[model samples]
Target: MHPLNDIFVQSAAIFLELATSEFMRYILAAAGLHLLLSTLLKPLVRRRKIRPAWPPKGQVRREILASIRSVLVFSMLSLGAVWAVKAGWTQVYREADAHGWFYFGISVLVLIVGHDTWFYWVHRLLHDKRLYQGWHHLHHRSFNPTPFTAFAFNTGEAFLHGLFTPLLILVLPVSYLALFVFSVHMIVRNTVGHCGVELFPATRGGRPLLGWLTTVTHHDLHHASPGWNYGLYFTFWDRLMKTEHPDYLKHFSAAVRAEPMKRAKPVALSIAIAASVFCAAVLSGSGRAEATETAALETISGRWVTEGYGAVVRLQPCDKAPMELCGRLDWIWDPASGSYLGMEMLSGFRLQGAEWRDGEITIPGKNQVFRSTIKVLDHNTLKVRGCALVVCRKQTWRRLESLPHIGLR
Candidate 1:
């Protein structure tokens, strides 16, 4: 046999052995957690399931199969990292002490933060319509993902996912121990995020500490909604980009309290009561029926066309508690923009003086939310203002008795 052929054979054998080991390691890590969280620990927190219904029949099975395929892809991609390491191209080191104890710890931190930033941007790019249908859509097919879905990725997506660690190794002097820790942390968090249960406890008011970490509800919403909550380990990117589902905090709070569906009843009831009171106040032409604030909030309710005729938004009570006020995108001028339709646009507005204050308004197309307030200028007009940091913008929306014809624009 030719010497080159023998070398080729030896390399192929090594690659297959490494791939098998990685595959088993991933399978065990994922499946072990799945057993603990989704099975063994499930009955203890059965009430905390993010979605009421069990995943569709065979969903977990499909996710497992896809995950296996992705693992193979990941393993194949691992060869590149192995080659880089052997060639002394990567900064990976064998001894943890080479970086000292503190730098060793810091390297782990760097890998996590860097991986998060890398994941956020790559994950967002995967959601592009062009990439989504062919690539990301495979993973998304498990709309209600399981722990197995942690590794489920399209072939291209697995390739992209696998590149992160290799690239990190090339750029940073990551110890093998740090790399191992990073890999372990990655699988554990990835599975937990996709575990279809909200495992994180909610902080008080759902705005501190645990709030910064991504909850199972956060990633579950990403599966259910497909267009929001793209973060993996933390809420930083999603919050900064304003791509977080408006109800994320509410959902997390409900999950932690094990009162997921129960919270909806009061919101629905409050909306009905508010509407009835407003109508009565208007008909009686008296302040006796409802508070002036209630009347104003009621008047703000209805479909209104955005400035420049961009879209129609319907204002109503948010499904979350306090039920102050919220808005949903009802219609858009472009049919292609229909995905933005029905998305929450405003949330948590409450009457303060003549304006509804302390509201959040999401900008169409930009996927950004800003501090907002709205006021009714007349029966037919509303003044809406939003601020990010110190920059503020205001727009007027005309009340729409009915939706304008899509062709009219």
Candidate 2:
């Protein structure tokens, strides 16, 4: 594992261990709020005498099969998770005691990607022309689905869709608790999306406002058009795959149809930004300033290398100010980092338009990278140098004029 990463994981584990009490209390508080919402708010909907029509009987078979497939796949995924943990897949996950956090994260990420792959395939299959006429067409019967409609699927379609995660786990190694959390989050999100209840977008207690679940309008539209809005939890797949309804905006309720789903706000923002940039460029005479390539970035323009406990740095254009104007280091090898620690040198430093102007000299090292400058110091010699901290050292060059013309050209 990377040293910085290792330290970060260890620190997080310690923090969690130390704050277990606070963590539990926070969990308890969340649970309490959920309980209150279920007992109070949900019942209000029932008392309001609102009920939605269930999907056709044919659609019912899909949900039943989906649930079964979901269970089977999860059991297999458990085995995969165990195997990954035992394998010590990476240095990050090698130290089991210290790296459980990353291990868990890895497992969940694998599960999600796996699920997406499978869901995409299965969903595509369900939409296939041949299958839609027979096995998959029934689910599309609903014109406006309520909460009950979310699970409305053909048995075969549901099985294919829901089996993704478990099948993925068969090939992966995931933490059991992590899997559990992932499952719960997925189910809750799916169900709440289908719940058909528009929530207050304002913050309840300075937290996410209506972010806990997909809005009622989001799912209700799906039910209205079976081929569209098939995704659960997130909207990415539907939009990305072009499976979303074409008239979703036109038919959308005013409450939910605020400006045609906005087309993922960022697109407009990006275009606006681009247009603004273009206009700015036009205003500023094409926004292109005449530039001469005299150096790389200032931070990287100098020399660099990693040595023992401490490093050595040298600065050039050697003014009285003792910082890394430029310099170079000898050479070193970092066995752990698997990187070469080498020296660098440079000269003729000055502020160039938006960048530092200077010449660079580099000395490549084994298992390490190096850099420097070539100013054609003299015809008989060349400047050689390296750096550890800042500029390590600098010496006037005395070689065959320019380069073998090998890399220098």
Local distance difference test, candidate 1: 0.74
Residue-wise C-alpha lDDT for candidate 1, range 43-134, written one tens digit per residue = 53465677777678888778778877887787777777876876789998766778699999999999998888888999999999989988
Worst 10 residues of 1 by lDDT: 280-289
Off by over 4 Å in 2: 1-39, 42-98, 141-152, 199-216, 246-409
Task: Report the number of the highest-lDDT candidate.
Answer: 1
Each model's lDDT? 0.74, 0.42
Please count the clashing residue pairs in each candidate, in the order shown. 0, 41
After superposition, candidate 1 runs with Cα above 4 Å error: 1-3, 204-209, 258-409
- Candidate 2 residue-wise lDDT at 243: 71
For model 2 the local lDDT of residue 304 reads 27
